[model samples]
Target: MSDLASPPLRRIQRIRHELHRRDLEVTRVERLSPHFVAITLHGDSLANFRSDSFDDHVKVFFDDTPGEPARRDYTPRSFNVQRLELTLEFALHGSGAASDWARQAAVGQRLVVAGPRGSMVIPVDYDWHLLIGDATALPAVHRRLEELPPEARVIALLQVDDAADRRLFPEQMQVQWVETTAELQAAVAALTLPEGEGFAWAAGEASAMAAVRPLLVAKGLTKEALKVAAYWKAGAEAFHETLEA
Candidate 1:
């Protein structure tokens, strides 16, 4: 008998950043959809800012609250070193300090943002990619799609309240837009993973992500091949966690 070939190793690199608390001013705001707002912030502090991962999160501070500032995690949608600007997308789910602030965010308004702290850089050489989540994951998913080569194979399962919320991607990319978390889970369970080494990434409501994590593993994905995160939780404030098997 001949020895079997080992699967290609997928290495995820982690890099730490020098934490800086930046006082940034809102330079622009665009309503991407009924429930999503894109805000571009600019400041001198961002001159050396680096976010090497699509899913890197920064701490956004809201001082509107009477007590200590309310802090929340937000994904860096995009950044331009030359312009010293960083773009962040806020998902407005009716309520929450961040949501409220984004709902009325205006140019010239100052905000304090701190550490992405570190980045976990996932390689893009995988045979296929699976992205699953709700509107909250849009920034990461969208950024990833943009970063990937046009030839990359990707299937994105996104849950959005309205069709207008969906963003355009490469025509070759398969995007399944669902309206509910239940649909999102069903879509994942029914997914037929492509043959070859693949990576799965998911984020959204905590409970929903908890339910979807095992399905991916059951579909022949090892713990090392997938990353699932709880971007937010129902009835809980400032919640974020990465689920591990």
Candidate 2:
């Protein structure tokens, strides 16, 4: 077994070594869904945006206007260097800074975005794959689903505010949703995994992920097979770190 069962610590090291890894550039933008927008970001400087693995997210900085406190960490939904085009998916919650910015961002508008910073590069040859997330994490999850090998068997748990939040994905992924509000840990714990030697991924709320760790462990999945990140916290305005056990 590898000394580091997961790549998170290594990824953090990569971020520390190079926080401003990619230069920020805003190209074009479009609304993808009622709640999601696909922003086409461009940067001749982004020519070196090297990321071949899935779920690679970046720290995106958005300011209401220039010289203000820029706040946001966004993941590119899809990008291609050959075309010098990168896309970001935004969730319109009428809440966070990023959400509000994305919901109202216009073309010719500029914002600061950064990083692949490095990601959890799971081996492509793993068994079954499981993805769990809410609206905030959909972009990261959707990007991975489309990028994974065509034959991958995936079981995904989606938590949304209501039925309207339910959406579609490109690949053959079985998605189950739990209509929920605040408490998410129990809902996530109730998710059924797909058959096979599966690898699990969960992101979004900290408590939910905290709840997931033990359940996954109980199901006989190794710590390596699971990569859970708490992207935000309840009632917190900024990015909050995950509370580890």
Candidate 3:
């Protein structure tokens, strides 16, 4: 057979690999903190999943019952795709499909997952950036700060559980940590924004974001200047949607 007419060897291998790689069981679960649960699954099939500098999330599959499908979006904490190992942190909210699953998830349980999908990657070249949100948006906020090159001015307003829930980020970054005891929206609203170029990114509760959206716009930020998402809702199940309105 002519070389051009024959099937490529690499293409053949990829097709074969695709047949075997799909989903795996939950092999391990670790409690990273009181508020977070890091569940690691075998990474053999997901070896190609790559983390971007900004935000990346996956559609986590769950079985709430027979014949009824339930799915929720989750962010990967860390992953070693080669080793088939990855971790996902779940904020224990005591409700929602994801939070409930993480609350009761155990080693040996099975889960179906798909995609790091697309990235909400925001470059740090802005004159200044504001990361405002509650606990749910921590993963995105942390990733953004770490990915930013040193000497870049950035500020984050994070509402977490006391000091224990506060995370350490870049040395040059300024953080305003609010305990979860206070209202999530009010905490972010109280921030004294330093006068400068601001590209704000906020996520977490939807209603709170609804209020804050225009507040930032009124402060001279353009309508498209902010990137906001609601990872979940107060009383809804598996609520995951963009809060751009």
**Candidate 3 lDDT score relative to the true structure:** 0.68
lDDT of each: 0.90, 0.67, 0.68
Q: After superposition, how far is residue 106 of candidate 3 from its true place, in Å?
A: 3.7
How do the residues 1-245 of candidate 2 rate in per-residue lDDT, one tens digit apiece? 21122322212112221445445456777766677778887777777676555566677766656676556666667778798777888878767678877777777777666776666567655556778787878887877877778888777787888566577875577777776633455655565555455677877876666676676666655655666777777776666454343
Instruction: Please give the RMSD to the true structure for each candidate, in Å.
Output: 3.1, 4.9, 11.7
Q: How far is candidate 1 from the true structure (C-alpha RMSD, Å)?
A: 3.1
| Residues 1-245 of candidate 3: C-alpha lDDT, one tens digit per residue | 11011111111011111222247678888876777777888846676766563556777877778887688877767777657786777888566667778888898887788776566545566656788888888877766776777878787777776466677787778877777524656655555555545567888777777777766655555545666777777877778777665
lDDT for each residue of candidate 1 in 139-234, tens digit (9 for 90 to 100): 999999888988999989999978888888888999999999999999988888877787899999999999999998887677778899999999
A best-first ranking of the candidates according to their TM-score comes to 1, 2, 3
How high is each candidate's TM-score?
0.95, 0.82, 0.79
RMSD score of candidate 2 (Å): 4.9
Model 1 residue 210 CA deviation in Å: 0.2
